[model samples]
Target: MAESKFEQSLENGAHQKIKSLVGKWKGTSKTWFEKDILADDSSSEADISSILDGRFISYDYTSSLNGKPLSGKMIIGFDIPYQKFTFSWIDSFHMGTQIMQATGNATEKGFSILGSWGNPEYGDQLFGWRTELEIISENEIIFSAYNIMPGEEETKAIETIYKRI
Candidate 1:
């Protein structure tokens, strides 16, 4: 029998790279609600681990927003058939009662995924959210997110730089 693509990935492909993210990380998070305006800057911690036999990476992180406690969990995986990265995220502060599902291809340094959300009260208008995860070195990583309004440019919403702990 021939080795499956996913199996190949697990052995020496994207999954191998994903495994590097499994560990404890401590860092600082910066958030912005308005363009060019910093909102909250606080310490954050993340625990990442391989789940389901290294098929996916689970990221659970805790931080603060405006002096209030906030946390989020994310599941990231590579889709073999689609050849893209997929992620589902839910956070106490930004997500409220919703989960964001995103998909994208790999970037030069890492992966970038995009998702969207809208409120019914807002009359079906949706906004885009893009998240990027970049591994700078064996001990350092940078995670960032952008907010995209309809018919407008994307703006940086949050950025977190983490170091292995």
Candidate 2:
């Protein structure tokens, strides 16, 4: 029997690349609340691991915002049928009580995903969030996110550079 595409990926494709990220990482997180304005910069740590026999990758991280403790988890997978990447994220400081789900395609060095969030009480106003992960080298990676508002351009919200530890 021929190997399924996903199975092939697990052996030597995108899944293999994703699995390479499994490890301990230490880095610094920089956040911006307004365009061109730095809000906070702090140390951050993360653990990346493969789950479900390498079908998915989980990123669990801890940091701080405005001197308050913050933590987040993100699960990422490749959808073979859709030919896209799947991502779901939640965090203590940003998500509040909501989970952000996103889908995107692969980039040259990584992937970029877009998601949105809003409150019904706001009456149909939703904000966009874009996350990007770039693997620079065996020991380095860069993670970034942008915030998009209605009728406005996307602004860099957060960026973290990690080194494998």
Candidate 3:
């Protein structure tokens, strides 16, 4: 597909935004959903405390799901000019990548990224989603995840509150 001039501008801005996310952030999160019963049970903690390195533009996220270990490395990058920010991840369970674009700049508090990813385990189905990051400070932030699937009732997948530790 042909690239639009506006897209180029956004891409450039997104790169800088991604750069901002390159730092140590710590927080906690909660999962709330209607159909996704397993995630909403709240039996275990969904807290996150991560350290992001700018040199590699990568992050080490540590958390737990149902009381099991959850950790991954997402190397953040952009395509060009800043149209979108790609999050390439690899961890104990999945070895895949997801990209989220700049929906807009930080609002009252932080920023939001809107994008979708494919879940091969879920029959390679495309899952539309968004992640909101609220910067509490230079060392702490909050991450919230939501599902924005069209035609389907909106659902909350997971929310991770992060802090720099």
Candidate 4:
């Protein structure tokens, strides 16, 4: 007998224990656009909230890089037919809107979210954009962004380490 895809995903999501990620966090982070150190910043905060019983989660992020404000939100579905997450960000300073899909699971260190997405505003400035989120704790996380130009190599757009307040 073989387990169904839904069954497998359910087991995976259950074993992942993503509920440990619910909380509020504060930390400093830096933003690099196209591997060119755009700014080194730390005035940022992140809030993560979730309802395990409801199978819903949300992330609210607010930050400033070089005096410009950046904000984004992510909504996730857990223990469902398909375990996945969705993200959307509107960056006022960079003038970009980013949307991404993610798959997550519990790990020894924390929850790991592997995702990929693109930014329309930076399409010309930077190509083939994607991001990764590593939840270090209930209040700590690391976010890294990547971009690959048509002819040039892939670059890390941003890497930020966050901590709980």
Candidate 5:
């Protein structure tokens, strides 16, 4: 079948939005295990790139957590067929082998994705997960994660502030 006009164009708005993230960023991540107690804090570096002819944004980052190597990769794409923003994330940590994914609309500042991280083989999840990616500017971004347990308050588990290098 002939490719749709969107697939044929590399200059779409979503593509451009993804393009804006292509750069190196220096940042720090704060992981909280308790309400106010200090937990793991680490410096991080992110190298984002526009790949697959601007159809997707590749995000790769590395940091040390508890003196062990921690790294992750995320692919951000706009699904033309479904008209939704698509994303998949994998990491050396955070569930180990679960390829958490979510689809949502793009916000003015950035995007919000909601998915679950649990036993990959099981159906229901122990908790729900929400990921927010907000752009502060061309120079900065915020990545935050929240955990939702039934009949409990939404708890913020992780947040990383990235500034372009």
Candidate 6:
């Protein structure tokens, strides 16, 4: 007898890779607005958990931005039918009133998601955002981002280095 693709994915698939992120972590994050110029540095905490019977990973995190409190929730999963990773995120600081959605796949270390952020004042694209992650080990991870704007060169917006606590 053969098993269905859905059943096979549920037991062993890309979702397993996403599930590896579950844990508690503490780290430091650096924010930049210009090339090689550090804008801010702050401490961060990550609380990751598996939800809906291991179908999705929900991560909650906290930190500070420019001396104010910052928090966010990130949900990640693998869509078996689509064969790509899915991500939905929202934060108290960056997202004004919108949820940032992205889709990408697992890399050698972690995963990267490319998505657009910001709404046009008159219906035009404002900017693009890419979130990249690398899990060096079970206890250590690196997360970074690239912000793309029209005409201007790409820039690193934030980089977070986290370790299990």
Off by over 4 Å in 2: none
Per-residue lDDT tens digits for candidate 3, residues 100-150, read 333434444555666666666666566677666676665666666677665
lDDT of each: 0.94, 0.94, 0.53, 0.60, 0.83, 0.85
**What stretches of model 6 exceed 4 Å from their correct place?**
1-7, 10-12, 121-123
Worst 10 residues of 4 by lDDT: 81-90
TM-score of each: 0.97, 0.97, 0.57, 0.64, 0.86, 0.90
Candidate 5 C-alpha lDDT tens digits along 64-154: 7888889999998888777678889999988587798878878888887877777645656566777888999999999888877756877
Please identify which of the two predictions, 1 or 4, would achieve the higher lDDT against the true structure: 1
lDDT of 2 by residue, 1-165 (tens): 999898899888889889999999999999999999999999999999999999999999999998999999999998888888889999998888999999998999999999999888866989999999999998999999999987899999999999999
Cα lDDT tens digits, model 1, 10-114, are 998888788888999999999999999999999999999999988899999999998999999999999888989999999998998999999998998789999
Better of 1 and 6 by lDDT: 1
Model 4 agreement with the true structure over 1-165: per-residue lDDT tens digits: 998654454456542344455677777777776367675665677777865553555767788777767777766554454544434444554434555555655445544455544455546443444556676665677777666575787777677787766
Candidate 1 weakest lDDT stretch, 10 residues: 116-125
Which candidate achieves the best lDDT against the true structure? 2
- Encode model 6's per-residue lDDT on 1-165: one tens digit a residue: 898775576667676676877999899989988788999999999999999877889989899988999999989888788787778989998887799899987788878888878776725866888888898988999889888886687799989899998
Candidate 2 lDDT for residue 98: 100
